[model samples]
Each structure stands twice: as structure tokens, then as C-alpha cells.
Target: MTYSGSNYRGAASVPPAGGSGGARVAAAAGGGPTRRGLIGSAIGLVASVAAAGGGFSVWSTANDANSDLDRAFDLGDLEDRPEDTPALNVLILGSDHREGNAEEDARSDTAMIMHVNEGGTEAYAISIPRDLYVPIPEDPDAAYYPDYTGTNAKFNAAYAWGGVNTTVKTVEALTGVRIDHIVEIDFNGLIEVVDALGGIDIDVEVPEGQDTVTSIHEPYREFSEGVNHLNGEEALDYVRQRKQYADGDFARMRHQQDLIKAIMDSALTAGVLTDRGKLTAFIESTSDAIKVDTDFNVVGTAIELMGLRSDDIVFMTTPNLGTGDQGGESVVIYADDPENPEASNPEAVSLWEALREDTMAEWVEDNPEAAGQDEGE
Candidate 1:
């Protein structure tokens, strides 16, 4: 169970609980986050992106029964799942981990909500900035300093206080959608999967002055201006480097979102699927880095989602109302109001409503700017 190396060496897959039950996928239980791949900035983002791709089958197998999803998490006495709910809202939290210090308490640097429509035809991923000031639930026994007597803290603080449980709770309270599943992706699993699949390509949008390499971390290869083909390390550094750009975290979000698109595109590609060797390695690496809830099913659900492709997925960030000083610290605010923030913003309310109702296709047309993925890709 302890992480011995960067690649999760000697990893093996346990056969899932249902649906052609003999098949196994890598299900190594990760201890905590490390700092070396502080891609915690983007590290968890990488693995979860692949987890979304890799967990497709696993997410399907769960039928509210004794399954892998049940083995994945301890829900205690909480309700099994929400009723009248066929749609799924999956929250993926990415930690900024450092090497040789995996136990160091870390905050969720990246959080994404993937809202899948009932039919699985259209889906959208909304990236919430870590610094967005939002209400965090009280967690007396949190990993970091607990957030008792809830306050409007930075969105990332939810994970620090109570790990994925608090993060999922805070997201549900804010978005008004009950989270069906939670996946935590660590640093190593992402790099392994990307490398195992050869690599992924994404279009890097650089302005006049700055280059892709921002002097933060070394890259595997130098990234050119346009479409850059990157291996695991190179892709991690590329997306994690945000300070070099004027846009700051938002640029990093774009790169991360694009990387998700690229991963999904690559996974659904005909060549990768047909090439059993590549597909097998990719699935194993991805599943190793992921931690799912007890109720998640990989078989039955994934079959219904056969139509999912890269082009079908949409990615966008939370509508940033603007920046302002809150309690003397600068923080990102939501839309509709400058004076009052925190989910009360008109646009934010409307956005969450659309998600709850599963009416994103109509909402996308109403708000052109929030639909970033559709703008180009």
C-alpha cells in the first residue's frame, strides 16, 4: 500500500465486483499526496482526467450492490444514493503533492465537476478555481487545520479540512447537486498512464513575451508555440506552470481542461482502443491512481456511455465575478454581485440550476462566455 517509487511499481489490479467479474484493474490504495510533482497544482488533475477515462467501465458496474464501488470508500451510514437521479455529477479533487513528503498535509489545488446528461450524449466539466471564496463545512477531524463553525474560505480549503468528504459536501451545498461519486488522483498514476499511452498532444496558446517553459520545473522537451506533443512529465510541467502567464490560474485551468479533452480524445480514439497493449497499460495506470466510492459501478454504467467522445465533452471554468479583498486577502468572487458573493450571484445560481436540471445545452447558448470548450474545440 505504501508508495515505493514514482511509477507505482509492482502494481496489480483486483477484479471488479460485477459485470464479467474476472477482469481486474489497478486498484492500489494511495496513502496521501507528495510534493515533488506539485502538479498538485495539476498532478491530481492529470490522474483524474485519466481516471474519468479509465473508470468508465468501473463506474458502470455498480448497481447499488456489493461491488467495487462499495470496496472503494466507506460511506458509513450516509444514504446510498439520491433518488430520481440518473444523471451523475462527479467531483474530482487534485492535490498539489511534493515528492519524498507524501504525508505533508495538502489542499485541493484543483477541483472539477463533470456533469453528465442522462443519456450520456452531452457532458460538461466546470473547473472551480481554488481561491474562489466559498462556504466550507465544519470538519473537526480534518487533515489540515480543521474548519469548524463554517466560514467562506477558499474553495480548496474544503479538502484540507476534511479531504474528499468535505470537498464533496461543500461542492454539493454550493452547486445544489448531490455528488454521486468522488475520485482522488495522485501524481504518479497520471504520469504513468500518459507515458504508457505514448503521450498526448495539446495546443498551447502563448502570448508574445512568455514561453511554455516558465523556469519553475524542468520539462522533458521544449514546447513550441502551437500544438505541442508532450510526454507525461512535459505535460505535467506545461499545465502546472501558471505564474509565467498574466492570466495566472485561469491559464493553467485552460491547459488542464485542454489536457482532459486530449486524454478523452486519445482514449476514445480508434487506434488506442484497438491496440490492446496500449489500452491495457493505460487502464491499469489510470485505475491505480484513482480512489472511488463504495457504490460506483464500472460495468453496467460504462456500457450506456458508449457514445462519449472528445468532441462531446465541454470544459469551462466557474464564472469569475471579479477579484476583491475579503478579510484583507484577495479572492475570486462569483458573478451577479460585487458587494455580495458566495453562490448568491445571479449567474452562478442560474448556472447551478442548469446543471441540476440537466439543461446545459440550452444554458450554453444563453451564456456564450462560460462555454469555453465550445469556443474553439
Candidate 2:
């Protein structure tokens, strides 16, 4: 269906496949990074500090700051849910919008599902590889591509074909996890957001055999080994590199995660929340760069996650069998074939079950290999 400008009055509850789904909360909204172009920055960080007693007034102020983004996009259908929900699942899409490219032509560069568990104490950012093969639901109201027949394609193609709503449906169908909110971010704006923070420090580690990673884009900035202070432009260049590293896109994903953590840390340590001037500049820069679904209450969501520290959030990739070739296309292979259970990854299925049940803390402990290692881990 086409976007009808209808706001999600409350959390939309979709039962998890094969599980007695519980009430899912929809209180927090913010950015969580995932892939090569995945950049949510600290938009949610604004509310995160609120969890630390920033107060309802501060949250209201921040919400007012982002008033323009209140209805940034029309997310087709979401029901008003009870406040007693257990967890909040947010679909954070990092879109790559190149010069002269229309929004319809943009593909999701990064697609991550961030699950904020009960009590809002822990959050998990799980990256869904853009190239993962999945079934794309038919979008009859597709704006740009009217000929879209919606068949199996790369995961990101959902956005390319019908936009964020399609991607939302595709992800829900694939993972069996209901999304409570949506945050779409243009990584291109990272230049200004990072610059606003006075630059972020990142420990750039090229593969063991390589000395440095060079930018594929213009200016070709060179990022050397060890911790480097990067301006916005240089930082963009750094996260965009994948071919230079032996792990390819995985390396890029790692860098993006590190950059995200760095941005959050920078904002908190720089006292952006305390400093009126810096806070205004940061919020302005961020609000201009991101579009949130109408239902996402910036301040309310942040207040819900007030107890969440930066460290409490962990990043990981969806369980997969690495990369493989499908129909002459390089794709990430995962156990998503429900028609043939023999073809699905048991671990992947388990992951989805854990997410729906809000048992990620236990899931991570049971499957440490699937958990992503942090910057120095």
C-alpha cells in the first residue's frame, strides 16, 4: 500500500511466528548503526541522556527541536498498543543517497533491527546484510517502480522497489520480529554531524597485510593504523572502505559500528547534553539528516531508555553462512527458507525466536560466536 500519512498511534503488535507473543513496548526511538552506509549517529542519544535524569522538560525540549521530523514518513499500518509492552523493535535503515540520485533510486545501504529489551536496560543492534537473499512482498502502490512484481531478491531491494514500508514488511516477514518504530538516516550527512562534534577519534585497523586504507571516493584520504582524529569528511571516507580490507564488507560493517560507538561516546563526553549551544547545534544537524516515522516520540523513547548506557548496546550480524552466489549475484546466505526447513539455519531460527521472546541476553550468552566483538574486544 502507498504511504497514506497515517500516524502509528501506538505500538503495532504482530505475533511472532510459532510463539505466544507478549506485549511489546514502544517508548524509545533513536539511531543504531549497522552496515557500510549505516549511520544513525546519536539521534537517540538525545533521549538516552534523558534516561539519566535529563528530565521530562529536557526531553520535551529535544522533542520540540525535532518537531519537523514528527511525520517525516508515512508508515502504512501500526496499531495503538498498550503501554505495558515488553520490548521495542526498531528498524534503522542507513540509506546511500548519492549525488543526483532520487530518493526512489536509493537502496538501503545498511539495514539493522535494534531490539530494546524489557526495562530498557539492554539493547541489541543486529545488522541484516543488504545482500541477503529474501522474498520481497509485492507492492501494488509502489511509487517509482510500477512494474515491481516482488519476487525473491537481495534484502535491500525492498527499499529500492517500494521504499521503507516495503522494507519493513520484508524484514518482518523474514525475522518474525515486529518493528515498533522506524529511523531512516542518510549517511551522507555524517559530514556535518561529525564535524558538529568537533571530530571523533577512531582506532583505524587495516588488515594485517595492508598498511593503510584509502578512500574510494574523491580526495582519497588515507587512514593509517591506530587511533586517528577524523574530521567529518575523513570519517565518511573511512567507513566507506571495504575492498581494501581482506574481510571486505564485514570490515566495512565493523568500521561503521566503531564509528557509531565513537560518535555516541564523543557526544556524551563532550557534554553536548549539558552545553546549550553544542546541544542545539548537534540536534539541528541530526534532525536535518534523519527522517523518523510519525509514531516515534523522540523524547518519550529516550526517557524509556534512560537507564541504557552506550555499553549496554551491542552489535551483531544476523546468523548467516557468509557470502555466496545466487543467480549470478553475490549474496549473503542465511537460513530463511521456511518452505523448506532443511535449508534454514537453525541458529538463525533460534535468533529470531530469542528476539521475539526478548531473551537476547540469554541468546548472546548461548551463542557468543554470533555476538560482534567491540572495538578492543
Candidate 3:
């Protein structure tokens, strides 16, 4: 899926998927159009946070089809998240393994930080290229994980070397932002979630000769694009089709962001909140496919997320101005500036810094209204 700036407008108009399924809570206070009203909204937001506190209980009590034992790790005592922290940074990892694959563990095809501002009015998501070189920490002795001597390697390799903790540590070291939570979704689980919400509508800007690329799966084949509706399998291929594009993974990140926005729009429009059975089933199908720290649970997460509207989400790539080979492997280097050295790259470091400072209000003041919602509400 390819979206120009205009496409962002259309995406904002799409309502959120709503159903009685999954965990549901009251609408957050201060969510309506008043600056002081946001305080009430913040209180309601805490309720949602409280609900998320019990997310695991909801997952455990819900359906368990295709569940994996490895996906069930607890968050321990990592709480103490400051209520005033301007942004909540969540590390979302997409593993590239499907059912019946010989490989027990799959490489992460995608890694991103979903930054939600303190006010919850604006969100910024930035993707980390899997190939970018980064330092990996030593592995735990009891876990039998690979130990790295702090040598630079592909970003994704950190996960294979140590697991989620190592990946979080590596990213924290790179960005200087503390990750409040982590979520992993596998290929099968992603397809199932998309299917459950119904297919997402995506606008594909078909470049000339786009039809030459063949499809990966048998039933869902690739086709010429220009506003196409995609099912789960087809959407998976849509975002994962880096080989066919000249821009490689950079293009893939754009498509991935588009797919995510599409899913959020469709899911909200479908009223997933009101449909309890469907929500429960959808959660069950995806539960085993994901791994989150113990502190994160469905109830609290639902509450925290409930405060957000589709317009609240923002997506961009890391700023890259140069490319070169490190250790005989290709890598993309983030320029100190992409738009202008004096001006920060909206894609990478600056956006993160804005989130870290909880200054999205200021950022939004600088950026044109993209979400189309009332500002400061």
C-alpha cells in the first residue's frame, strides 16, 4: 500500500473498527473537546490502564486455539511508569514465520516504536530497519542464548541472539528511550487478526510494470493496484513484498504502516467493541501468536488504548540520508537531518525526542493538522 500526504486525510476519515469482542471499557474522560476536560479524560485513561493491568487474565480466560507456551511471559515488577511521562513507547515486533515452517524461531521482519503522547491526542510510530547495525548485549547464562562481544550487527540479529529483553535493551541503547512495553505478533496470528476484523481497505499506487511481480501464496495472488480491498493473506503479501520494489525495505515499511492504519480503520468501523464473541475469538486466535511482558494485560491495555481514536495514530520511517556497507553487509545510516540539517527529520530522532518530552502539542503546532481532529482536545 502506497499513501501520499493526501492519502493520510482519507485514512483519518475512516472510523475505528468497533465490536463487542476483545476487552472493552468506558470511554476515557477528558476525551471530548476541552483542554481542562482532558483531565477527566486522563482519569478515564487510567481506568483503561487499570483494565490493561488485568489483560493477561482476560487472555487466559479467553479462547486458546493455536496457543504457544513460549508466548506467555510475565512483565515482573517493571511498573513505576510515570503518569507524567510524555510518551508511551511500545516495541512492536513482527516475526516472519508461518505455520509448519521447519525453523523453530523466525527472524523479525519488522520492528517499530509506537509512541503515544501523554495527552493521547497524537501518536508517532517509527520503524527501525532490520539491517541497521547495532550493538548486542551478552546473553543470560542459564538461557543458552548467544553472547555478543558488543560488535555491531544487523538490528534483527539481536533478537535471535538474546530474545525480547536483548532486543529491547539494544533499542533503548540506540534511541535513549525507555520502552514501557513490548509486543510480538507472528505471521499466522497477524493474518487471523486481519481476517477477524474483516479485510482492510488500502489504496495502492501502482507504479508502471507493477504487475510483473508474482504472488507468494497460492490463493492470494498479487495484482495491479489502485484502491484495492485486501484480505488477511493478501494484505500480508502486500506489506511483505520488498523483493518486488526497488526501494527494498524502505518501501516495505511504508506498506506496513499503511496496512496497520487500514486495520485500525476497518476494526473501528466494524464496531469490534460491541461484539463480545468476535472480540474474544479474535483475541484468542492472536494471543498465542504474541508475546508481551507480564505487566501488559488485555484489560489495562484496552483501557489505555480506548482513549485513542484512529486519528491519534501517526506513522513514519527513520530518517536516512546515506547508505553504505558495514562488515560486508549493506546498511542505511540515519542522516542527522533528512529535511534539512537545521530542521529535524520528522521520520526519526526528532519525533522521538518530541514524544520523550511529551511535547506532541508543540510538534502538532508545527506540523499541519494531519489527523483532522480538533486540536488540543
Candidate 4:
């Protein structure tokens, strides 16, 4: 079963005004909605099932979501990949566009790689820090920028320079891994998705000794140390906070992971999947929040990975040597050498090898620290 390539129609479809690279960045920035959303589309695509006798609604919902994604984002030119590969690597880029933040200032706030192994029973979510210093790939789409690849810049800059296409190239160049698909997540639909499911429970764990973490946004909601029910707005505020944590963005990433897992759990336990009204609302909100590459078969991949669950997925971060000051700007000192394809951070190279070879389970066991959690006693 093969799917035809999609015909995308978005801000990326039209060339930037005046053929200016800056204009391209500005155009891409304004694409996302005002309020930040969640990674709902990623789950919505696969959460549907063709039920017996009354499966038409589910089937129809999935089809609508698929069509929405098909017309979503333009991935530019990427390497053609066969659908039957032993493993799959999907690059998920989360872009945020807040009010008062100029369109030209937009950048990918979150970047994660979802690697599904050969068996499709388990998966890995590898988050790359946006500040990780890496070599920017020359944008064939917008070649106006001089020396685009000469100086190393923050990882998220790839999206600002040329949207998804440049980001894909940069990741491929850095990890030595081929990207099977691309997903651009808009942070504007989280509220609706969470609201549709009633609300989600997130266990807020403050850093070691800290008692509680307060939201930086308005109203300053305080999250105590334990399971707290979060509505759409509260969920948005909770995950958007990073400054309160000692590790900053790293802490926020973990929270985001927690939110995603919680949403899934809430849907399952709260009967969102079984209740047609809730399910419809969930799917519709999710589908509206994301765009994907043309060839990405959301339903097909979901069907192939039917039995997958939250516990089966592990979230990890790319190896880095913490934050550092580079050229007067703070950046994440990536453990790998981005300029050279053959040379990379030893541990990161091993991680990439495991991903490429479909041996991440063994790799995770051996490198527990990089697995995003400490080994239990």
C-alpha cells in the first residue's frame, strides 16, 4: 500500500517577498497561531481505530485528519525513502508564535526525533536542545543568506532560515541519520485538545529541594508537588514554564513529555477514544495543530504500530556538554562535531548507530544516564 505525495499549500508555498532570507523567516514565523498548542496532531493521527459496525466515524475522523496533514507544511526537497524500511526516524519540530513577538523573531522552540524500531512495538523520543550549536545547512530554497553553512548556530535557527527543509538537512548532517518524515507542531491548539478531554493530571515534580513551581505567565498559577489536574489553559501555562527549573529547558522538555503521556492516559482512561463526541473533538483539535511532510502516512503508520503504548516509549535528549557562551550568546555545547560528518561525539555516535541499526533498546540499557531518567534502586 503506497500513498501519493501530498500537495502542500501554506506560507511555505509562496516565495518570500523581495527574495530576502529575512522575509522568509518572517513569513514562516507568522504561520503558527497566537496561543501555543500541544503535540496533539502527532497522537491524533494514530489514535483512531476502525471499529466494527460503527467504525465509520472513526474512519472518517482519521481521513479528515490525514487530509489536513497532507495540505499542511512544505518539507521542501528531502531524500526519497522506501516505506518498508526496518526502522523509521521522524523529526518533530515545535514552533511557537506568541502575541507581541514579531514574526521575524520566530524559531523552533522544540525539536525531537521519534525513532520507531523495526518491530514497531517500542519507540524513542530524542529531544535536541534548541540551543545546541550546530552547522547550519545552506538553504537551497532561500540562497540569499551568505555563508549560511560557514558559522555554527543554534539548532532551532534551521527553521527560521528556511523552514522545515533546512531543519531536516541540518539534523541529517548532524546525526548522520536519515529522516523518514517531518512534523511541524503548532503550539496554538493545546487548550482545545486538553479541554476536549476534560483535563489531564500531571505530577509536578519540582527540582530536588524546591517546594513548588509557579507559572511565569499571567495569574501566576502555582503547581504543587504531586498530581494536579490541569485544564487547557493551565496545561499550557504549566508546560510553558522553564525558568523556574534549575535545568531550564531540559526540565521543560521533561514536563512536556509528561504532558503528552498524561494526555494519552487521560484519553484512554477518560473514555475519549470510546466516546464519539470527545473523540471527534480531540481528533479535530489535534489535526488543526500540526502539519507534516507529504509522504507521511499517518493512518498507515498508526495501523502498523497499533499496539504501542506510553510505557513502551522512552524520551531521551541528544548528548550535550551543558550550556556555554559562544560569540556572546549562550548556547548548548553539543558533544558532537557538527562541521565534520565522519567525526561525532562518541556516545552520540553510538546512539545514532543504535537508531540506524534498530538496536536502541540495548543502547538505552547500557547508557542509562542519557535515557532521561536515573536507574531505580
- Residues 218-257 of candidate 1 have per-residue lDDT tens digits of 5344566788777877776777766767777777777776
Q: CA shift at 307, candidate 1, in angstroms?
A: 2.6
Stretches of candidate 3 off by over 4 Å are 1-71, 74-86, 99-104, 138-145, 208-213, 216-220, 270-277, 335-352, 361-377
What's every prediction's RMSD, in angstroms? 8.8, 7.4, 10.9, 9.6
Per-residue accuracy of model 3 over 146-200 as CA lDDT, tens digit each: 5562556777777666656667767766665777666666666567766776676
Number of the top lDDT candidate: 2
C-alpha lDDT (0 to 100) for residue 300 of candidate 3: 33
What lDDT score belongs to each candidate, Candidate 1 first? 0.56, 0.67, 0.51, 0.63
Regarding lDDT, does 3 or 4 come out ahead? 4
Better of 2 and 3 by TM-score: 2
Task: Flag regions of model 4 displaced more than 4 Å.
Answer: 1-46, 49-54, 79-85, 98-104, 143-149, 340-344
Candidate 2: list runs displaced more than 4 Å. Answer: 1-31, 34-37, 49-60, 78-85, 98-100, 336-343, 373-377
Model 4, range 17-87, lDDT digits (tens) per residue?
22211101100000111113345223533332222113655666665676665445445456542222446
Q: Is candidate 1 or candidate 4 better by lDDT?
A: 4
Q: How many residue pairs clash in each candidate?
A: 29, 5, 40, 5
Superpose all Cα atoms of candidate 4 onto the true structure and report the RMSD in Å to 1 decimal: 9.6
